[model samples]
Target: MDLDQSTTVESTQSGSSSSGYCRTNSEISGFSEHLTDDFNSCSSETSSPVSWPVTGRSPFRPTLSRFGAIRHDHKLEKDDKLNDQKPTDLELEMMKERFSKLLLGEDMSGSGKGVSTAVTVSNAITNLYVSVFGQHQRLEPLYSDKKRMWKREMTCLLSVCNYIVEFVPASQNLQNKPSMEMMISRLRSDIDINLPALIKLDALLIEILDSFQETEFWYDEQGSMSRNSLSGSFRGAPQPQRKEDKWWLPLPCVPAGGLSETTKKHLRQKRDSANQIHKAAMAINSSILSDMTIPHSYISSLPKSGRTSVGDTIYRSMISTSRFSAEYLLDCLDISSEHEALELADRIEASMYTWRQKACSNYPKSSWEIVKEKMEGDKNVVLAERAEILLFSLKQRFPELAQTTLDTSKIQYNKDVGQAILESYSRVLEGLAYNIVGWIEDVLFVEKSMTNQQES
Candidate 1:
């Protein structure tokens, strides 16, 4: 009754009796009467009360190929057993939300950007499992349906597993893992190859955003009370007002003197002076702040870490902005509360120092210190900050160069120069804010799953 002895049973169009055919020594498909005999012999032998080397394999003997099939059968059996344990609706919703959060790339628990450590990675896994289990319970309805939505669920599950495999090592220092750089690189490749849906989901999200960008807001109109506080005429109560007639402030006036070459030259010189002043101011600010003491509770409150794309995005962005320090970026992320912000700042600083010691051996070189000083100067903070960030990123990528921070000391500071830098940085933040708001609107408004797809 070896596996090679497969039997095939064929029934005629009239639905007459099914005749079984046995394959003596080849790949065959059909019902084999010996199937039960084979299963009994195999199961009995494996689950034997006593272990011994039999004289010879049974005629209903199991081959390696058959054993593989048996293993698969066992897996199916186990899956069935587990599937029987249905989760509650609330659990499923939680899972869906968790999965959605990961898909959308939001940090489950805030770790402030780039300073990933073993603890952080472990926390992410814990969160992911919790969320997955929750979703599993809620998804019972999908399974209960006669129609096959299981395939879709299976596909999504597989994708989530793949994401977990890619995220875990980085999240947990299971085996003295490499830096986040390598992990991220591998993840990018995996995303491009394995979990393309995540990316498509992201793009689809953006597409939805682009589609709604043109929608005019009533708040944009002149005298639109939407943008203003509830206070009315003379700060009393709400008063009726026409839309177009409200007085709008004119754009800021450019430095006097027309658009002549002389004016341009004067403006440039003024800018240079301003840049110098700004550099000095930044320097003062930098020296004024040194220690960052983060609170544990704040770090605890950040979205629990997960394999979410948002987590990855946060990681990469932080790594990319290494010059500003993790603390600064955490500030930028603007997690729900001020307390969280402070805690994130402390955590980042602590992580940075640890990484610097482990990853960057040669303490701050004189070249780096001098450059840092110049960059701190108010006017030069922009360039200095940019240079530091670039240096940190480069160092992270090439640990061998961790000792060398870029030298931006030669770039003198000036108020105008600093203002220009600040202006540009402000614009970048503003753009990001818009993008985030737009994304939030899309997720909260757009339906991810069709309410009823099978109908039409």
Candidate 2:
């Protein structure tokens, strides 16, 4: 009768062959006990209820149906498909058009509906420069000869500068208001003081561009004169073209031989004037760009606290006015860790899943659970936004649950959320900067290439 004690079991009403195998009653009892214990352990794990951390009640557990899980998997597959597709030509064209409008002072929205007329003119001027100088073929002839081509290119550049200067007055008088007129008048007055300087700078730039001169003598093959005859001796053989000299060599002005003393003195005076003017122009432009600030309207529209998309607008404006300011803004935004931010975002998404599961089990019948379940059904809700809404709802319903959820998730996830937001803002700023800089550099490089075409 004792289950723990060993006892032999005898077969009843059986043949000798069937009675051959026998087992102890104690061993059989022990095997049955072991099986029962294993069953109990498995049942406890699978069927036992999860306890709420704060409250002792056994809340209703919300289980995801097989169909719902399958739907989620399908959504993930669709997202992967979308991500795998490359951007089409149409998309690239649209992006370029929007960026062009941004450089022309349109807002980041790229609506281009209400831009100012001055901005339109500015865009036209920029487009003209791009169309003319952007072509390599158009500039190839300008740089064919190192010694002579620079003068022609410099002359062409002076004309271009003159065109810009003429447009400056029009650009300043854009608004046509009395105050703007006064401002234009003051700008003209200042230009008058610098007019001499500007003119000298122009002449000096041309001289600098054409400064390289390699002496050459042409031998007159038709001359039938003896070499010993001083009067008709064949001129020294024409000096070979010094193709090795660069076109943009900024050589100092050298007095030409066989010129009068008066002409040489005047040339020396002009050379000094050109140098002084060049220095003055560089200093003035540098000072003007360095002191520039974001417009009042731009700054006023920015958010007083957290990050905003308006920063892109500010960045574009800065780029149009000053490269230094644009670079400074990029530095301030600190966009280099964008990859890290994205990785952290993915980690936060994973952590949020774990938090949601635990929080859902704790507050199964609460209003927060209702919101979460409703949001779960909405495929459009992003993970970060959904997490924010859930947290808000939980705080409203039960503060204890919200605090416990935060404690469980820890601070790393929250820090990543903040960093991700900053990174998003920085990316926008970076994109705007790149587009604007590219446009400006394209125009500038054309001018530079014309002067230094040999290197090109």
Candidate 3:
């Protein structure tokens, strides 16, 4: 029952120190000698006394030895000698009986010797050999043309199973932590040492023993049979089917519109921060477009001067939120001038998603450029409409950026630019009361006109 522990136990010999646990050949030989000695002692004590022939006891009956002790001692010596010699029919029969008893965890005391024991032991030995060795074909000689031995062998096997079920868990020292080799060795030893006594076990009990080592059952701690106990036999056999393997626990998702208050708060804060950053970037982008188009006199009309050139400051701001890091932009400029703008655009596009991790939405400065690219490639009006809808979504999600588009007025707006800005502006003010609606309506109407000359 204790599936995890080793069954073979190493004991300290009569003469050796117990500190180290190593078994030398000499120690084994000594142990064998000791077993032999015990057998001799028992046999001598149990042997019938040599008696006087005529007077029945006139000449002192040489002290009668106990017959039982003699039988026990003779069995042991027979077993020890049998290990060296080819097992006799009688010895083999004895072995099978003892094997069964050991497996049943029954006391193997008085079973007599016969051919049946030899056959059973032979088969059990063969089975053990098969259990350890690579191939079954090599052991065909033993089982060939041998039927009675096979029957006896079956009993031995059943008994072995029963023995294991009872023996494994009950042996506390082995149960603690047994090695595989030790278990196998003990199994071999039990068959070797207890053969004669296992001859008498019942057939039904033997079958119960055989099922303990079946392959299909998973013997975890919580399984039907405990490694520590064998109070009951296996009620049923394992099913043949295999179950599918899985890596993760399965669970359902949270419902829509069921956001927690803390989640909503976090989302709002994130949206606000992204909007602020996006607004600063767009302000610079708008300025860059203005600087590219507007005259110096038109620029001078707008704002007060400082140490940083307005154009350079605006360029830096636009480039900062654009996508590529400051270091990358500087490197690209230093490396190449021909595709500087396109390179910058690509970098911005590539880096847009990186910032959206904190924002939950991709409200990068390069988003407008992305929209422009999509618009240029678009053939269907519905596609353009969808793009516009997405743009409106961005404006609603990020109000600060929408406000920036309205406040920065250095560049006169085209029809397309005016419509986009007005849409953003309307979304930003929609939740405000009637008074603010009028103000927003007026801002929508107020657009900077682009003349035919400027367009040309």
Candidate 4:
């Protein structure tokens, strides 16, 4: 399900004339009417939504801010390059944060009656409250284990169903308004759509350890539930009057399902073995992922907003990849049709299983990094001995392989680990490969199925 796509979207809205700007009949007209007859000019920037009515206090002035925004808009309107500039990912995030704090003020709207932004700041805070600290489920850090990887991605697919339901009664003023009516309908839709997807995504993927889970499972009694707090974060959101009661963090959890002695022992043994191998292999800097090298041509091709700052560039890649333009993938795979897209996806999937994509220790840029320190030079003499014995046994089984490719620096070779190391290394490699493949397949299969439905 379109996990990478963002739900929020906006466009610049302007008027036919300066007098008509934002004064046009619409939701934002509520704020326009409040603008005094004393204003000299209006800002025509697209982001001038009704939500933001910058506060002017003793030190700051909103009038100058409006003129500055107008000047900025004028410069953008004249120059194609500047006009097309969009906020970088970071700038966009900051803007969202500012806007999400509930855009309108009582002073600006003049009255809390008849007009309110479609979404208010409370919802945003409430969402933040639920996802991170509330009883919202979060995934574990991405490890090289299939179960662990899936668990992490399960959180990647944010479903409202994952959030614990906290009912907040509407203000007495908004109870009968159309804005409130819209909010109710949207809430119903979100619950209907997201709840099922959340449950299915969890069940289909990895199950979180009960200890690692959020506050209370739905099956728990109502009184046992966590209230107005973050769970499992081991932190607190203390209120003014309730400074002493920081219950959000250090979440209260009940002991959950236990394992049998035999199963527990088996898992403990594997965990210990894996932990030892990991500790020996991983460097302190291992957490750093390989950075994507965006070409100069690609950057130059984008609008000025994308090339302006580090944040912009960082966000550019996210925007480009998150939503398919249908150009990059099709060009890379040399496909234009739904059938071809599906075929290309299937071909890519199969090629990954080949030596080309799953190349062994000797291939260029190998994943043998996990056991490399031990196997390549036998840095850990003890660990290397294990790999050495496994290699020896393999050579014995196929003398020709040992004399040729298996012994050489070529792709088929195995000069690294013995059986134990090989087994452990393979586990890591398989997990990564499958995770990568699965995400791409989700996108491709989705596109293919949509196209198929259209055809029929």
Candidate topping lDDT? 2
Where in model 2 is the C-alpha error above 4 Å?
1-115, 124-187, 194-196, 213-279, 287-293, 301-456
Clash count, one per candidate:
46, 2, 24, 7
For candidate 3, lDDT tens digit of each residue in 342-443? 233322322332222222224335454454454453322222233233333333232222122212232223222222222221121111111122221222
Q: Name the candidate, 1 or 4, with the larger TM-score value.
A: 1
Judged by lDDT relative to the true structure, which candidate is superior, 1 or 4?
A: 1
RMSD of 2: 38.9
Per-residue C-alpha lDDT of model 4 across residues 103-147, encoded as one tens digit per residue:
442124445542223222212322322222123222221222322
Candidate lDDT scores, in order, read: 0.27, 0.27, 0.26, 0.26
Error of 2 at 373 (Å): 61
TM-scores for the candidates: 0.18, 0.21, 0.13, 0.16
Model 2, residue 151: what's the lDDT? 23
TM-score of candidate 1 to 2 decimals: 0.18
In order, what is each prediction's RMSD in angstroms? 30.4, 38.9, 41.2, 30.1
In model 4, the number of clashes is 7
Q: Which residue window of length 10 is worst by lDDT in model 1? A: 19-28
lDDT of 1 by residue, 1-456 (tens): 010112211110011001000001010111111112221211212232212243554322221111111111111224455445666675477558645443433444554432223222222332322222212211011122211122223233333222222222334234676634323312223222322322222222222222222221112222343325323211211222212322341111111111345433433333333223222222222221111122344333333222121345445554453454644554456566433433333333333333333222333444445544544543223333442343333323221110110011101111122222222221122222222332232222211111112122
lDDT of 3: 0.26
- After TM-score superposition, the amount by which residue 63's alpha carbon in candidate 4 deviates from its true location, in angstroms, is 47
TM-score order, best first, reads 2, 1, 4, 3
Model 3, position 141, has a per-residue lDDT of 16
Candidate 3 lowest-lDDT run of ten: 19-28
